[model samples]
Target: MENCPFCKIIERRLPADIIYENDRILVFKDINPAAPVHFLIVPKQHIPTLSDCHEGHTAILGEMMAVVPRIADMQKIGVVGSTPETRTGGYRVIINAGPDGRQEVYHLHVHMIGGPRPWKDNK
Candidate 1:
C-alpha cells in the first residue's frame, strides 16, 4: 500500500479530481474515461478485489453500493425507468477482479459510467 497511487491520493500526496468524499469512501473522475461520464467509487479500505472480501466486509460493501444513486444524481444522470414510456437517465457500475478481469489497479473500486452513448472525442 506504500506505493499505491490511490493511497497517495487519499493521503493528499497526489492530485485527483475528486468529486465526492465521505468517511468511508472517495469518489473521483476517471483519468481515462470510457464514457460520457465516468468516475470511480473507492473504499477507504485498501481491498485488493471483491474476491478478497469476507464477512467483516459486509457493511463496507453495503455502504459502497448505497451511494450509487446519489452519485448518479450528483452527476445529473437520470433514473433508469423500467418501462419504455417511463425510461430515462442511465448509469453502469463495474467491478473488475484479478488479472482476468482486466483490473489495472490492485485496489478494489467500483466504476460508475453513464450518459449518452458514442461519447464524442472531446480532445
Candidate 2:
C-alpha cells in the first residue's frame, strides 16, 4: 500500500481533485479521463480488483453501490427524467476487473462516465 497512488491520496500525501469523501469511500476526478465527466469511487480499504473481494467486504461493496447514484447526481450525470414515456440523460458505472478488462489501477474502483458530449466524434 505504500506505493499506491490512491493510498497516498487518502493519506493526504498526494493531490487529487476530490469530488466526494466519507469515512468509507473516496470519490475523485480521474487523472486520465475517458469522458468529460469522469470520476472514480474507491473504498478506503485496499482491495486489489473486484476478484479480490470476499464475504468480509460485503458492507463496503454495498456501500459502494449505494453511493454510485448519489455521486452521479452530484456530478450532474443522473438520469434527468425517468418515466414510461421518456428517459433522459444518465451515466455509466464501470468496474474493470483485471488485466483482460483494461483495469489500469489494481485497487477496486468504479469509473463514472457521463456528459453531454461524452463520446468523441469519430467523424
Candidate 3:
C-alpha cells in the first residue's frame, strides 16, 4: 500500500486537488482528466479493486454510492440547475475495475466526468 498513489494522497504523503474528504472517503480532481470536469472518488481504506471487496465492505460501499450524487452536485456536474446549457444536467459516473478496464491506479475509485462537450467517443 505504500506505493499506492491514492493511499499517499490520503496520508498526506502526496498532494491532490481535493474536493471533499471525510473519515471514510476522499474525493479529488484527476491529474489526467478525461473530461472538463473529472474527479476521482476513493475510499480512505486501501482496497485494491472492486474484486477485493468483501461483505465487510458493504456498508462503506453503500455510503460511497449514496454520496456520489451529492458530490456530483457539489462539483456542478449534476442536478444543480435546470438550464439545458448547464453542464450539471448530464454527467457520467464510471468505475474501472482493473487493468483491462483502463484502471491505472490499483486502488478502487470512481471517476465522475462532465462539463463541456460530450465524451469524445459518444460523439
Candidate 4:
C-alpha cells in the first residue's frame, strides 16, 4: 500500500489532475485517457482490488456510485435532454480487476469514461 500510486496521489506524494475530492473519495483525470472524458474515481482508503471489497465497504462503494452522476453532470456528459427519446449523451463506468482484467493499478478504482468521442481501448 505504501508504494501504491493511488495511495501516493491521496497522500500528495504524486501529482494528479484532481477534478473532485472529499473526505471519502477522490476524482481525477486519467494519465492515459481512453475517451474525450476519462477520469478515475478512487476511495481515500486503499483497497487493492475490487475483489478485496467486503460488506464493510458498502457505504464507500455506495458513495462512489453516487458520485458518478454528479461528475457526469459536472462534465456535461449525461442527461442533456429530459425524455429518453430526447436524451443525447451518456457515460461509461469501468473497473478492471486482477491480472486477467488488465488492471494497471492494484488499487481499487473506477474509470469514468464518456463525452462526445469514441471510447478507446482502455489500458
Candidate 5:
C-alpha cells in the first residue's frame, strides 16, 4: 500500500481538502465531484473494500454510518431542515469496490453526494 494515494492521504503524506478527522476516520472533499456536494469518508486503517472487512471492523463501520447524517447536516446537504430547492433535494451514499465497481482508489471509502442530480447525459 506504499503507492496507494489514499493511504498517503491518511498518512498525511498527501494533500486533501479534509473536512473532518478523528482517531479512527477521515473525511474530505472529493477532487472530482459527481455532484455539487461530494465528499469521501474513509477509515484510518487501510481496508481494500467491504468484502475485506472482518467482525472487528463492525464498530468502526457503525460509527461511520452513524456520523453520515451529522456530516451531511454540517455540509447543508441533509434532507431535514434544509431549504427547499437549495441543493438538498436528497443525497446518495455510495461505496464502489474494486475495478468492476469503478473504484479508483484501492482504499475502502464511502462517497456522499448531494445537490442537484446531474443530467443523465453527463456521465
Candidate 6:
C-alpha cells in the first residue's frame, strides 16, 4: 500500500483535486473523468477491493454509502425519482471489484458520477 496513489494523496505526498475529506474517507475529482461530474470516494485505509472487505470495514463502508447522497447534492445533482413521471437528475455510484470490472486502481473506492444519463461518450 506504500506506493498506492490514493495513499500518497492522503499522505500529502501527491496532489489531487480533493473535494472532501473526513477522518475515514477522502473524496476527489477523478483525473480521467467518465462524466462531467466524476469523483472518487476512497477510504483512507487501504482495503484492496470490495471482495477483500470484512466485518471490521463495515462502519467505514456504511459511512461511505451515507455520504454519497450529500456529495451528489453538493454537486447539484437531483434525486433519482422512481417513476418516469417523477424523473429527476441524480448520480450513480459504482464499485469495480476486479480486473473484469475495469478497476484500474487496486484500492477500494466508489466512483460517483453525475450530470447526464447514458454517459455520452462512455458508451
Best by lDDT: 4
Q: Show the colliding residue pairs in model 3.
A: none
The stretch of ten residues in a row with the least summed lDDT in candidate 5 is 81-90
Residue 7, model 5: Cα distance from true site in angstroms = 1.3
Cα RMSD for predicted model 6: 1.9
Ranking by lDDT: 4, 6, 1, 2, 3, 5
TM-score of 5: 0.87
In model 3, what lDDT does residue 69 have?
87
Clashing pairs for predicted structure model 6, backbone only: none
Q: For candidate 6, write residues 4-76 as lDDT tens digits.
A: 9989998989999998999999999999988889999999999999999999999999999999988988888
Stretches of candidate 2 exceeding 4 Å from the true structure: 118-123
Off by over 4 Å in 5: 81-88, 119-123
Off by over 4 Å in 3: 80-88, 120-123
lDDT of each: 0.88, 0.87, 0.86, 0.92, 0.85, 0.90
Candidate 5 local lDDT, 49-86, one digit each (tens): 88899999998888778778888888987886455655
Task: Please estimate how well model 4 matches the true structure, expressed as its whole-model Cα lDDT.
Answer: 0.92
Model 3: per-residue Cα lDDT over 23-119, one tens digit each: 9999999998878888898999999999899999998888888888888778776766566675346578888888898788999998888887866
User: Residue-wise lDDT of candidate 1 within 20-123, one digit each (tens)?
Assistant: 99999999999999888999988988998999999999998998889999999889885967899998988888999999998999888999888887664432
Give the range of the ten consecutive residues with the poorest summed lDDT in model 4.
114-123
Q: How close is candidate 1 to the true structure, as a TM-score?
A: 0.91
lDDT for each residue of candidate 2 in 1-123, tens digit (9 for 90 to 100): 998888888899999999899999999999988788889999999998999999999999999989988988887888866695687777788899999998887889998888877365311
Higher-TM-score candidate of 1 and 6: 1
> Clashes in candidate 6: how many?
0
Residue ranges of candidate 4 with Cα displaced over 4 Å: none
